[model samples]
Target chain A: MPLVDRVLLGPGPCNPYPEATLALAAPLLGHLDPEFLRILDETCDRLRTVWGTTNRRTLPLSGTGSIGMEAAFVNTVRPGTVVVVGVNGLFGVRMCEVASRYGAEVVRVDHEWGAPIDIRRMLDAHPKPDLVAAVHAETSTGVLSDIGGLAQAVHARDDNALVIADCVTSIAGMPLHIDEWGVDIAYAGTQKCLGVAPGLAPFTFSERAWARRVERPSTWYLDLGLIGDYVSGGAGGGRTYHHTAPTAMIASLHAGLGRILEEGLPAVHARHQAAGAQLQDGLAELGLKLFAADGHRLPQLTTVWVPEGVDSATIRTRLLRDFDIEIGAGAGEYATRVWRIGLMGPNATPARPALILAALRSLLG
Target chain B: MPLVDRVLLGPGPCNPYPEATLALAAPLLGHLDPEFLRILDETCDRLRTVWGTTNRRTLPLSGTGSIGMEAAFVNTVRPGTVVVVGVNGLFGVRMCEVASRYGAEVVRVDHEWGAPIDIRRMLDAHPKPDLVAAVHAETSTGVLSDIGGLAQAVHARDDNALVIADCVTSIAGMPLHIDEWGVDIAYAGTQKCLGVAPGLAPFTFSERAWARRVERPSTWYLDLGLIGDYVSGGAGGGRTYHHTAPTAMIASLHAGLGRILEEGLPAVHARHQAAGAQLQDGLAELGLKLFAADGHRLPQLTTVWVPEGVDSATIRTRLLRDFDIEIGAGAGEYATRVWRIGLMGPNATPARPALILAALRSLLG
Candidate 1:
């Protein structure tokens, strides 16, 4: 199956670590078994280290990133809960959508597609939003918002309002200091900077955030409190069955987390930065303009303007079919205007940028 | 990883086909890539066949089986929806819990843990109920409900009430005629008789069931209608983004489905039957009593009464740590009274019974 031999340079789901894939092939273990419980403990420890937090209330949700996004709100947001969701791209918009489903009255703070959200405006708009959520990195637009400042702004308005950040693209890619950033809750996917295949969503909630819950979460499956009790050990330190966890996927994530820590989170972040600079230089040499603003652009996911009069889809098809390479077509306002190239995870290397650039130049020129 | 060197005899997650694990090592693909879209088409078509339904609404939810169970109700049950749920095991109780989260007015029909639900009473108790839900196979007690008869009985009382089923342990293990049985909605996990790793939830819904929706499914992540539109190709046969699907998990499932089709459904069911009978014969020879009612037990999962004064947990731990074998602990009313020996998936073999029996005999004899 690996013989498909395509270079993945997409918005997310950058190529996973080879070790991660091998870990996936490892024999399955029952979720409640002692061996798996040990693995779960190690996985959670590694997650905490990379997240730059010591929060004990952390574990991977048994769904993909979107459900992880849902977990943050579904477990905290109740009917009549006022949520201030900042919208910069598709994922930000999705937060409002998911929150409203749980009966939250969402006040959306709209920002430009390729720009970081306006923190001051967001705090001013919703003085006492129950949950203030913003994407730490918008994969759709390749824009990275300043979560530290956002969290500070949120608490300045309402001391009890929880600050939630979507770190689907930013974790292990760039610096994300959860405790230092004052983020009360955050959720991230394994596919991006963690160099693991996409299946589980690693999430954490601060003690302050956990204490503020009004009622039991509406949903049963995604209830963090119930799941926490099961994972942190049921009453008297024994696990109660939560759900049949995706064993192989979790194993892959565990191995991926191990590699991240081995490399050190700061070093992984640095590699992504260097790779981003390499792609930026290559694109500039090709006479292409970067889509996101210079200062706020994400180092892992780079966006470039589609040359005028060139069909974006045609280039993508040719890249995949002929060159065995994959790049992402844009979404929303930028759908026809840009192409996103990812240098996340194991794909975050200068060689990847060089190869993709050569393929693109041959096709475009 | 399979070199952990243990034979799995759990209720579900029975030894997956080796090919499924290999497929997981395949290189990553973008969720919206053309190649993946083609793969998605093939996977859905294969699932439809296994489910014995022509319903185009079939697809694998991107989470574990519990979400699949949630999908049936979340998509249809609205606030104040009347739901008649029959309980005989832990999974039945799970159905009641999940359905209630969707605001369903659940009328729980209780039954003995090891006996089939009283269908006549269930139908008569909730006359004209909006929905009738039952478990086809109770993994906790190893009783297989007569779904075809139950479907007829539910319709006899309320023609409009949708008949839903938890086919987690039933699908592919034994005969299941979805369309012929008139089951409006059915859901299953991959790790069961399907012989795939645990991650994806393969599910199906009838045309009549699909047509009865009032408001959109309460939750977004498990919303089948939106996911169906995306998988079926959005407006104008164009695919749209839903959730970032777990590429490796889906690939593993695709390969698992291929193995099932190659074996052919009836032969697969027959294999399970043979394995079940062998285990039954061995258990009877050991002078152990089966827990479920005569002529009503599931072939895939066999429940046996634990000998008086034998610590079940100690035996389970010894079987795993000493003999490199894993079976299941009992649940609910049956807890401390029985052990669930699974013959599901590829592990359902006459040889498997012989191995487990010898180990049990050596332990007890």
Candidate 2:
């Protein structure tokens, strides 16, 4: 295959740090090796700091964020459990789907696509759910839901019920307080805001969430209760033998998290906001309307309206074929109506915005 | 963390080729990037050749081998599906656990922990199951089950029922003909015999397996039907989009597969056989008894009885602490009775056997 270089401005698989890539090439070590355990311990420590949480269960799941979502639902919601999900975008719908698969009686508080979740409606729903789930930053519509407000509303109804949140597109790029916000469980992917290739899912849980997992589910592979026990000295001598973790992926995550700490989380968030604003301004100058409302937009991912005369697929094709740049097409209702351009982690920079605008301007004209 | 070098002779997390690790360090690419799609296509093509099948639905699931096992069960067996699992070792017991998690009525065909699955007993079981699953190479006990004969037995009872096999420790290290062996679906991990690091689970399907997947379960993530649709033009215009794949892991797998091709699969198999024999001979000279019968032992893994006075954990710890070598402790029935030694992928060589034996002799004497 010919060498193809792409300026990744899509939803995920963001540009990785050079050091992160090098870390992936480190010599292979046994998953339970003491050296590798040190890596795991350090990675978990950094994840807790990046996620703004004090939860001890913070660790990387052995699969992608989607599987992390499944693990969260499968472990917490058994058959006959009632789960209330806030559905405004793709990930919200995904949460409802996963909950229902685990036999949860799912209730959805629906909002218009590209809008923040309706917190009032969610609270006023008829039956109190056994679990409340929402997405902090919806990747598809590029909307940042009011996670604090949602968590507050859920706790008001049923304090015992777990509050699950998908931080896939947010986490390191935005403010997430698992403990302060009373979030029982939260999951994030490594690819988007973490500036690493996709593989591992960094997840954390509160004491309440841990209690729920104690009632073991039928699924053995994702039995986080068993996994947590193994990782938390249950395996004996501070070593655990769970599934063979994605070793290289974990190494990359460690490097990425180290870079995140070096840059500092607050500064990283500010950079994302600045880069997002610049891109939004450039898009506006080129006559492109933003799909998400101004105050609710995610700084890491921006969704723009697809003009009527211009085909989304055609535009995306030209961007790749001509400019060697990649962007995300809309999903669900926005399939042909919008496009998602990511300014996440290492790609959140002034140079990327200029590159995207330059290519888009020529194509639009 | 201290830089610790230990030879991995455990069940997995074995030594990976440096080229494969370098491939993992390649620049991050979007999951759907044109270049990445090209890699994905080539990976499927290469995996098809390695699996010795012409099935169009061959692909890698973005999880560990255990998750691949879950995917097979969840997709193939619905609630109340009568599934018969061969139970001769730890992996087989794991199969039953996963099947039961999906609400399958699981029946076990029992055998001694270190023995191959009995074909006649499995055939004589009354009222043949809807799905029959077996482990090709049981890692826990170093027993090689007769997949060819097991497939025949399942077919004799009910040709319509599917046959699933776990080739976790056998795939490229031994001969496996997915089509000729009449296996409907099979999954293998990269770390074991594939000479890649742990992450991706390579899977392939027969036409019958595809038909079962069409009766989609409630699962959206493990739903091969949806994944196949997205990957095979079902999402329209052949533009595949799902979760972000572990791009680096896939790249490593591509490189690992290239190495396998370079060595040639037949030669790789022969090497494993030679290495297994060498280790067995060395163990015999040390007065240690082989756990599995002579003809039924797995070439990639060997289980040996722990002598009366020596603790299995102590010896394993000594190997790691004193010799800088890693080996596995047995599981379940053989937990305190045996130890597992692996000769897999890049670690499957004459030099490793000599090193392992010398270390064991020092510890035992």
Candidate 3:
């Protein structure tokens, strides 16, 4: 099959910013090239700014958001470490699975799949836990949890407990203040609101998180301490070689971040807000009921219940085949009942929502 | 820190093929898109051909070569499992570190850095080791080890023993027969000989290796079983969601592999051999001593001793600044004594070496 143009309105990998798309084709650079190193440093600076942190340990990991999830846990959750995870969606559920892989004594605070995380329940689950984790924007359900509120509650109870936030789908699309929210560790995907392709994970670690990092993580590839040393060269001003940095992906990310910051982060967030509002309001006009809980729905991703008497897969296939628009189907039990439509990064525009809404209207009719 | 085009004559990422570079700019595709899936399947098929393997579990991992090294061991080496590692260079040293982290009882078969692995010594390291491993090409020292001979020796001793090979710097540039040599597990990088920018690791596992895979690997991101399910799908003909695949990097890899296959693998390897020979002869004519052992030096990466009284870093800097050419300086103790140059993929041509040699001559004079 030949490559075809796609209007990616699925959970992520929405159309990247034009600058990022172009940057991918740029000539290859060696990982240790001085020019590439400068680009890398500048890229990390942009990440810190976007994450709303002054963290010195900020750079893109070589893998995607899922690796980010793995690194966050593998570096902090030693054997028998107590971890409280707010499970509101698939990602939250994944946090428990990943945390437990590193022998974390995971305390699951369960909530409805489409509902925002219950902070009170999360706080009450484990006293003086080593880590508390929550997905700021649950991509699976299109629900947005309050990371700031969760952090405030957790820190109030146990100041030493680290707060790790999954900002994979929220960064650059929503209001996020990693430092101010007391989020000790945060990880994000580039393909979502950052308007880049899916390869690199934008990761950060606060001073407290860094100080408390595992001396030697089980997984060598995702070891944050080694990666941090390589990414942010030590006080001696030389990068310790870890792995071959994905140069092209980092270049694209640098370009993508440049596009976002150039447009101004707040303006980027506003655009996504407008696009999501447009999509949700249009879906309502088409007689579709939203799936996520009211008032806590994510602005970048909107989940809607599949109307009764409609074949979900057929409509989705038609939208993709006939309209070149791709929307996401719900996972697990909600597979046939819910649809996830995203308006992220470059795709988060009034025109995109209008185009997708019209495509849906035609297909449903 | 403006982006400037430099002739990447470094150890790896030696200037991507134009086709691969162009493919990176292709429009975004959802990870689950049918077109992308077809492309991915074809890409894996190409990888099997390049790897000389019939392994059903062949696909690109969403990380670099080092992650490939990590995954190969993390999936097989359980606690107290006796594993024999041939440590001649940095990557081999890395394998022992990575394997030991997963609780493997590592037995190191030490070899000189600039020489090929001693297969006899490696076999003698452990009589009944569960896994025997060696690097096919040492990127740091530019030495090529005989993985086929090592596999034959190890399997002769114990057929149940898994033989893992690090083909990171050897894959498309040198002769590799994964199946024919009975290599149970092997992994490679894209940036070296594949003519693609770094990101994905082309990985493969034999039937025996897959059968003995760790049921619950500690690292979720590098879990081959979960990734295999998603890449190859199942008997039900549906791909399970593992993680978001790096679409653009994979596309670039697909294109790079296509370019190589189109040119013919033998032709590509011959080109690399010819270019390397030319560079080595030119360096010898310049009165520089070759570092790697005779007849074992890689036909893609050439390491030579920096001439006496000639500063390695100063010469490298001059080449980059004056001629826009980037070559690698040796790591660790050899940092000031040796220079590593690569003619890989698109840069594996006579003209590239000729240009670099002329630039070096001027600087040395």
Candidate 4:
């Protein structure tokens, strides 16, 4: 099949900003070229602004957001280390799986899939744990949790414990203050709120987290320490050679971040918020029921229960085949029962939701 | 620093094919879109042709070539599994490090830095080992070893033992026959000879190797079993959502492979060979000495020793700043003693080397 134009309105990879799309076609640069390194440095500086952190180790990992999750645990989690994970959606469950593989004693605080994390329950699950983890924006359920509140509570309970946040779907679409929230480690994807193609993971590590890192991570490629030397570089240290970076992907991400900052972070967040509200209101007007908890619902990703007697897969196929639109099916058990509609990045506008709503209304009628 | 165009004559990441560069700007596609999946499948098929393998599990991994190295060991090496690694250059030494990190009892067969791997020495180093590994093209040293001979000899010693080859720099620039030579596992990079950007790793696993894979590896991201399900799908099964793939990078790789196949594989290899010979002859005429062992030097990358009292870094800088040309410095101990001149992919022509030779005559004088 040949490539076709797509309106990516699913969970992620929304149509990128025009500048970001064009950046991918820029001529190749040697990974170690001085000019390319300058671009890399500037790119990292931009990453810090959107991530809302002063972390010196902030840079983009070569793989997607999932690799970011792996790097987080592999760098710090060691044998018999106690990790408390808040499990409200698919991403939280993945954290448990990844942490355990690195010999972490995982304590999971399970909640309903479509509900926001219960912070009190998570803190009470395992006191004095080495690390506490939660997702700020759960893509699977389209629920947003209070990461800042969770971090404060965890630090109050055990000040030594590190806090890790999965901000894959929240960085640019929402107001995230990693430093103010006391987040020790965080990982995000470029596909969603960043308005770029999915390839690199925007990752960061605080000084405290870096100080307590494991001496040797099991996976060499995802080792944060080695990658940091090449990407962000240490104080008074020159950049070291690691793996060949995906130069074109990084350039595109740099352009995407530039677009977000040009629009202003708060304004970008406001746009996403307005688009989500429009989408939610329109879904209700169409007689559709929202799946996530009412107050904690995310604006960028709106999950709605499949209407009664309506075939979910058939509607999705028609959406793609007839309308050239792409939305995501719910994960795991909710696959057929729920639909996730995204208004992220460049797609975060009132008009985008209107197009989807009109198409849905026509197809259902 | 404003994205200046350059002639990338580096060891890897030579200028990408025009088609591949344009493909990166193509509109984004959801990873699971049927059309996108079809393109991915075709990309994998193209990978098989270049890798010279018919393995059912062949696919492009999300990360670069180094990630491919990590996946190879993390999937197969169990605690105390005996792995014999032939160490001649940087990548081979890296394989030992990765395998050991995965708890393999690694036995090293050390060779000179610029010499090809001795298959007899590698097999003799560890009798009855679970796996035997070597670099087919040592990118750091610009030397090529006979993986087919190594595989045959390793099989003769122990039929059940897997034979692994690091073909990162050999796939499109040289003659590689994985199945024809009984190689059980192989991994390659897209940056060098594939005429693509450095983001994806072309990887394959033979049935025999897959049968003996460890049940649960230390990494969740690089797990072949999980990745294969989404990329190549099992018999009568559909692609299960693993993680969001780098769609743009995959599309670019697909277009790159298309260009290579269109030109014919043999023609591509011959071009690289001719370019290397021309460069080597020109360097000799200019009183320069080649670094790699005679009869084993890689045709895609020609390593030449820096003349006594000559500064390596200064020459490289001048080439980049004044001529807009980029070349790689040697790795590790030979970092300042050798210069690697690559004639790869779109840059594999006699004219490319001639330009570099003229530049060198002016600068060195």
Candidate 5:
């Protein structure tokens, strides 16, 4: 079979780092191999530094980004616990569903799509909430919420309330200091800003919030407390068998994280901001309107309203088939009315944005 | 870090096909990429062929073998349902734990370790069991139970009972006819016989078993009802987003399954049987005894009793460190009494058995 040479500039899963490719092909090892265990510990330390936390319970959840989000609720929110969640986009709505499925009394704070969430409205709900959750980067609308302000409000109302954020699309591309921002739990997917394939998700839990978890998590595959014990040296300094860790993906993430640290987080953030602005400007030049609110948009993912004369879905298909480029069409209410183009991780390069702009110009004409 | 050049003679994670490694490094596509959707369809087709059933509900689980097990129960066994589980080995014991965690009233049929389950006894005492589950190839004891007979008895007692099997260590290396054998649901891990890495798990559910599921599964991550719809081209012939599919691992499984079909399942089964006999005979000559019951033992994984004089754990450590070979040490009751050796997939070769025997001879003598 011939290899597909199309570029990935969609919502996520942009081309992984070249070193990640090497890590994927590295010789296989037993999950319990001493060498592999050492790799796990080292990887955890690096993830800690990247997550900007000293929390020891930090580790990668075994499944995808959604599972990592599920882990946050299943492990922390017990039955009958009141959770206040912001429902502005698809992701915020997903958080409510996940929390409610876990038996939480979800209190939703609604906002218009493509607009920033109102932290004050979310925090001023009746019946004091135990958890306040929102998406740090709402990928669906390309809007960024104020996590620090939400955290401050949650604590002011009740120091016991936990603040949770989904940093899946923002980690390496934005300024996110999890600890300083008071995010009790935050999960990031590897496919977004980390330049890795979409599998393992790095999620961390704060010391105070996790102390409330006395019962085992409902989902056996995603039992964070047990997985944490196994990943960090197990009982009696020996690693107990948890689920078989996805060795190839974990190794790939280790390699990807190393590249992230070497380039440095501050520099990576600057590159994303610059590249995002250039693409947004180019879209404006083509008479396309940006969908996200002006003052609080995610730089890494830009959503643009479909112009009146063009068939939006047709343009997306033509870009992929003819130009060998892929961009995302908006979902839910924004479907067929807007297009989401991502400039994340390696795709945030100045040259790549130019290529996308040129391809758009050629195809639109 | 230098790669370890050790031969995996342990119970699982045997050497994978070189082609699988190359496929892992293949250029990644977006989860919804047209090329990748084609790959997903192609992979589902190959999996259906390899699994020996025309069931359209078959696909690889994104997590490991254990999550596949979790999915089997979570999808079929509703809370408060009665399930009869056969507990002849560790894997069977685990089936009971997973079922009970999902709130099933699990009635366990106990058998001594290293023995096949008594099917008559298992079916005779049950208040109309909703599900009857057992291990096809128990990794811990190297015991192969009679899944066909168990399925027959399960249906004879009550046609409503779903016959579930754990074929984690037996899939491509054994005579597993899911439809003919009456298994409503069964899951297999990639690392064992499929010769892929240790991430993806391929499992299937019968139409009846899935139709019995009406309520949404508690786990958002392992919800088969939703994930199945997403994989089989969701409503209106467009795939709905469920979670980020593990593209690299899925691709590697696709490549590995292709190799399995090219070689044919019968040839793979025969190779494993022959190599297992060779390893058993060599161990017997070296003054050891096979632990599993005669005539019912698994050919890929052979559990052996440690000789009276030599320390079992010490020998395994030496085999790994000195001879670059890894073997399994028993847990629980057989902790220091047995060693489990594997000859599955790539490790089930003519020359590899000789190497393991030679390593044992040198280390022991």
Candidate 6:
């Protein structure tokens, strides 16, 4: 296939900062190299800042956010544990699936794909779950669940139960207070809001989550207890070699996080909100209906319903081929009924709003 | 910490191609983007060529090489499945640990660290284990096991028993004939001989192994059968969607593989061999004892026994602080007795060998 520049306005794989790319190209270092450790240390320090927590277990898992979700569940819920998952979108359902795979008794709180999670009902359903999990921003449907509300509800009933949140689509572009909201564990991917390349999943755990990790059944590779020790001067002090980390990806993340700091997290969040509103306005003017409920849509991603008689694939293909603009088709139940337009990271700009509007106008008309 | 220009002479995480790094910085693309899919297709094509296999199941697993090892066991060996693993190094021990966690009835073929795997003994002891696994190059002790010999022995007894080989330290730099040697399932990392950033694990399987994948019980995340379908043409025909892929990492890998192809695989292998010899000769002149037997040493990594009363950590620290050169301390049994010097990818240069020798001579003297 011939190479062509694309305007990414999808759920993820947003445009990256040039510096982040350059950081990736910097000289390779060993995973245990002192220099690389310094980079890891700095990256973790920045991660804590972005996550709004003082959790020492903050680090990047060397996989996508789905793996992050797996890491969170595998570490938190052992066999026969009771896991309550808020299932309003695809990611929440995935969390439930992962929890069940680990032999957890999963109780999913079902809601419509584009609707916000009902925290009260989730809390009322189960007597006491071993863990409560939800997605902060559901990438599949562009719905932002009330993470703070859910965390409160989960803690009010079962203080011992962990609260895990999938922040894959929210992290640098939204208000995520891991400490303030009493979340035990949270994870985010680089490509979405972090504006780095996708490969590393930045994750953090509160002290409560860390306490549970120590007694969890061992999964050799994904063992957080072992990984924490290895990272925190355990295997003979300094960086103990666990598995080889993706150095280039981490470097890119460091650069992306640096950009985040430079722009200031609040300003970045505001920009995402502004861009999201602009895109939503444009779509509405073009007779597109927002799939997500009002006041529940994620600022980073917007899911719009595919009008009747129009094939989502054809519109997406035409957008890519004719306009060089890429948007995401709905996943799961909404596969043919929605198109997710992302205004995330570098793509969350006024220029994207205008470009997407013009392309959709020509195509829909 | 101040950044310094240092030569990486360790077990993997060696120098990467500059172009590969730049490729990593390219605009982030969605995991299922058509353009990204084309790159994934190209990456699989290149990996197949390098792995010396025409099996349709060749692709990169999304995590580090350890994940590749886990995926291999998870997909092939279900609970109660008998798996015979050769334990001569850190990675081999890790393999046993991972397999055991998955409920595999793990049988061990133990050899002393720095010793080559005894194929005859392993086969005689196991007779007909469901799976026979071995590492091609034991990174911990720099020993190169007889992979071809082991694969033959495993297949001779039970043609159905899968032969799993860990090619992490010896993919492009050494001779690995997956097809000719009858290697059913083989996994490798990019940091070693591939001359790329570390994250993705390049893996391949024989037709027989692919069949085994179908019969395996379902796993939510590491289910290769499901992943293969999503990555290859899924139920959606040409459209494929599983987890979000690391797009930039794939791009870098593509460029790295391209560089390897441009140089010719044989030529790259020859360079590694020559560099290994040069390193060994220089170390011998410095009165350093080779950890592995001369003929069994891996071409990519040379483990040298530390001299009497010389602290390996102290020497390694000095090398890093004074010479800006990085090497590895012995892991497991050789923890304080040896240092692993790597000659991998672009780092397998005469300049690195000379610099490392000079630095060691200064420190040792």
The best candidate in terms of DockQ: 3
List of clashing residue pairs for candidate 2: none
- Candidates ranked by TM-score: 3, 4, 1, 5, 6, 2
What lDDT score goes with residue A283 in model 6?
88
Winner on lDDT between 4 and 6 is 4
Docking class of 6: medium
What does the lDDT read for residue B276 in candidate 3?
Answer: 95
Q: What TM-score does candidate 4 get on C-alpha atoms?
A: 0.99
i-RMS for every candidate: 1.4, 1.6, 0.8, 0.8, 1.2, 2.1
lDDT of 2 by residue, B1-365 (tens): 44566788998878897778778877777888767778888888889988999988888888888878978888887778888888998889889988887788988888888888887887766476788888999988999989988898778777977889999899898998999889999999999989898998999888888876636565567788777865555745565466778888988898899888888998999999999999998899999999997899987899999998888888888899998899988877677888889999888889999999999888899
Task: Please rank every candidate by DockQ, starting with the best.
Answer: 3, 4, 5, 1, 2, 6
DockQ of 3: 0.88
State how far residue A146 of model 3 sits from its true place (Å). 0.7
Q: What are the per-residue Cα lDDT tens digits for candidate 4 across B1-365?
A: 36699898889888999989988999889999999999999999999998888899999999999999998999999999999999999999999999999999999999999999898788778769999999999999999998899999888777989999999999899988889899998999999999899999999999998899987888999888888889988555888888899999999999999999999999999999999999999999999999999999998999999999999999999999889999999999999999999999999987799999999999998
Candidate 3 segments exceeding 4 Å error = none
lDDT of 1 by residue, A245-344 (tens): 8888888898998888898888888999999999998899999999998899888999999998999999999999998888888978788889999998
Give the C-alpha miss distance for residue B109 in model 4, angstroms.
0.7
Off by over 4 Å in 5: none
Interface RMSD of 2: 1.6
Cand. 1 Cα-lDDT: 0.87
Query: Over the stretch B185-218, how does candidate 6's per-residue lDDT look in tens digits?
Result: 9999998889888999998978888777635433
Q: What is the TM-score of chain A alone in each candidate?
A: 0.97, 0.97, 0.99, 0.98, 0.97, 0.97
- Residue-wise C-alpha lDDT for candidate 3, range B70-104, written one tens digit per residue: 88998998899999999888888999999999999
- Model 1 chain A is weakest, by summed lDDT over 10 consecutive residues, at A212-221
CAPRI band for model 1: medium
lDDT of 2 by residue, A256-358 (tens): 9999899999999888988999999999999889999879988789999998799999999999999988999997868888999999888888899989999
Question: What is the CAPRI rating of model 3's predicted complex?
Answer: high
